[model samples]
Target: MTANPLAPSWLAPPADANDLAASVWPANARRSAADELVFAGVPASVLTERFGTPLYVVDEADARARARGFREAFERECARIGTGVTVYYAAKAFLSSAVAEWMTGEGLSVDVCSAGEFAVALAAGVAPARMGFHGNNKSLVEIDTAVEHGIGAIVVDSPIEVERIASAAERHGRVQAVRLRVNSGVHAHTHDFLATAHEDQKFGISLTEAPGVVASIRSHSSLRFLGLHGHIGSQIFGADGFEESAARLLGLHHELLAGGAIPELNLGGGFGIAYTAADDPTPVDVLARQIADIVASECARLGIAVPRLAFEPGRVIIGPSTVTLYAVGTVKRVTVALPAAFETAPDDSTDPSAHAAAGHPEPATAVRTYVSVDGGMSDNARPALYGADYTVRMANRVSAAQPALVRVAGKHCESGDIVVHADYLPGDVEPGDTLAVAATGAYCWSLSSNYNYLGRPPIVAVKGGAARLIMRGESIDDLLARDPGIGSATRKASTAPAHAEPAPAQAAAQRAS
Candidate 1:
């Protein structure tokens, strides 16, 4: 089968549309003897039958292994340099009580950016001393809660946050540890919206301003200044950005150490993962060694001891460990005109008079199939939000049909509701077929919404041939229960399991009660 001109240059027609790339899928993902997609030893059909469509299936063992891999790799690398490392599971990627427990069990700390995330970590019984708090605009209440709970560190984003955290620590009669987030002025090679360390962003203070902020933090009697923190961006493919950012931050670290003890240096996590066949991210172990080398070289050059290193890796650990299973609802193949670059040149053999009479040849066109699924932006918003690309496969069963170029779309009302912008699926793909999108474990669930009134899908953890819900799917009653007008009755009559655990807010309120 020839490649379609409409397809992106990076997307090639696969030899077998049913084949799953090892780097883009969970370690345990495979095809069963019956040709059905099996994740963590459970068939996709069984999962959809039990949990319904648009379900998130996370490989428990895969996630744990990745977490352990990061911890061990960084530990070994940093140890070689006579220093230590802390791998914080960035909860903003996707957090559940189960996930928090998994990270803690793997000897990793948790990084929470909100009170709700903090509450979740606490509810999971994670030691507050191992958790770090982060937010550009944290409320006073949130700061107070972090201080009162004895958080390991609160990454101060703004100058005002220093005073807020200091006041909270004073009120709680505790000495709080804080890290000032600084902009290293390193522009990571990534999407503009994702690049954070650039000076124009809202994330951190300039390198120039960081000194004053650190001074203010040191002035506070109740605050312990840890060190500086910086995050370059997400989906980074190489180590150059980390190297550059570390060089800049290390320079600042050297100047600050002269004033007082600076024990830790946190380069926040934006590590990338393989979302599709086109993505080839650096291995965690290799990346760890590279970063360690960069930090060691910079510190040695500056004639300073290497500080304790910290990283918050969220996506690389979890992104490829899960897949979203969607039921195909519709399939429509439409002929689209190819761009001018793809158009064929006028034939020289044709006479000028004949060509003039016939006019220019009709624009080249190609067929693109739109495969609509039961879910959309509500379940996975990356495609619509970041214009993220993903690869899809026929999940319920495999076929020997030729590969067909497809655009997997969501059921949402918006035209931008896409799941996989471009991929090859079996030509026989049609309604009732179940499709799986790989590498959705990261921000998908955390950024999911009720757009078009679609309830969020449940996340199920699969391992050793068993499946269990880590989070329950939202039902219609769950959505209606939020309405003040007609929701009162719905809330009272809703038959959803009352045994389900409370959300962070509910948990906090329960503690108060």
Candidate 2:
């Protein structure tokens, strides 16, 4: 990055802005003579003109293929190691009864982090035993519901959670299987991972605190301690991270065995998928083989049996399968100079270059390409949250013109709300044309909100020129559907975590005290 120091390595100057980059996009995505973006053989322009702008078009075949890839890969790798394996598609990435049915039909397990997700899975007809209930702060009622439903496993994040789950399981007269989430403190990048002795994350119990929980759960007849689980982080493209995580988790397993404890092992997924040229997420088959190899060797070294492997990858399985199609609402060409970070940063630095434009520093007197679309932070918040970068193209038409450095933005009121940070676009890009942002199928819709009171985009599944609506857009009336009947009064909005259940506040006046 010429201007920014921390620019991601995958950002690059596109050789052809009009051409489709196959790695980050669906296999069938292409540009047609009409200059329209086509996915699954349907033109995005046609979809927009038919369905309107700010729509999410999922390549149904592609999504199914990705889910199958992970399932088959893990199955094959586990067979080679003579061990058991399971791939739990994290439902929070993007869920619908439609998607759940597809995943279940392909033989993949479902991992739900919330009650709403569990409800969707059941409504979609996925078997209860194939569902894995996961959460850091699951309510007692949630645990009771999962126990009553007889879901597969509840990943235990804390000892208190184990107690609640055990109590709920006992009340139901069922022995609930549990996995302890261990914070291994492994910091992993795309190509490198370091296993540290101490971890400082909020999600999991310390290694020291975990064994006691395992021992505690072992004492409870109503609960079954199935294994150890560790999720290092997300968007990792290399095997070394898994290797580090696996070896460390097994090391703990060995320690547990020495204390007469034999448990399964769950290495949580952050397996990377390419969002742009900067990302090189490992293929599912290759990554599974490598991780399986690591676990096998580690078990041999520790003189223990190889434990079953579990993965909960949301991005790799669903990310590349879908793309967000948007209509260019406004196009703004801004004059900007390259920032010092991009120009001065070293090549090997994994830092963000505040001035990087399309993997390089913004040049002095550079004409930045800023295209505004109908959706912003409401549709996808990763960019604004992590300063993440993305790529977009002229989806409605093809341009045989030179590429210009541009930033794609949304119509939200926040100046900080941007979609594609910096990328090359054909100079002639304009309004009324369609734009398809790549690698959004994972986090975009899953994290979408009603910010600015704007309607959330509908998710439409596209297959063989046929499209079906999965989730309809919200209306103003839908936004106010739950309003209280207090005359001339409105409750103050709460700052609860997104996607988490709402924490409602009472509006009672206490009868004037």
User: Which candidate's TM-score is highest?
Assistant: 1
Q: Per-residue CA lDDT of candidate 1, range 1-513, in tens?
A: 567667889998889899999989899999999999998889987887777778899999999999999999999999999999989999999999999999999999999999999999999999999999998999988999989989999999999898888889999999999899998887664423323444887888999888899999999999999999988888887788898889999999999988998999999898888888988788889989999999999999999999999999999889999999887767898877666565433332112232244657555667789998778898898999889999798888889988888999988789999999999998888777788999999999999998877788899999999999999988777878777787464455553322122333442353344
Q: What are the lDDT scores of the predictions, listed in order?
A: 0.86, 0.78
Local error of candidate 2 at 140, Å? Answer: 0.5
- For model 1 the local lDDT of residue 300 reads 95
- lDDT of candidate 1 at residue 98, scale 0 to 100: 97
Stretches off by above 4 angstroms in model 2 are 1-10, 258-263, 338-364, 485-513
In angstroms, give how far residue 78 of model 2 lies from its true place.
1.0
What TM-score, over all chains together, does every model reach? 0.92, 0.87
RMSD of each: 7.7, 9.6
Candidate 1: segments with Cα more than 4 A from true spot: 190-198, 344-361, 487-513
Worst 10 residues of 1 by lDDT: 346-355
Q: In model 1, which residue pairs have backbone atoms overlapping below 3 Å?
A: none
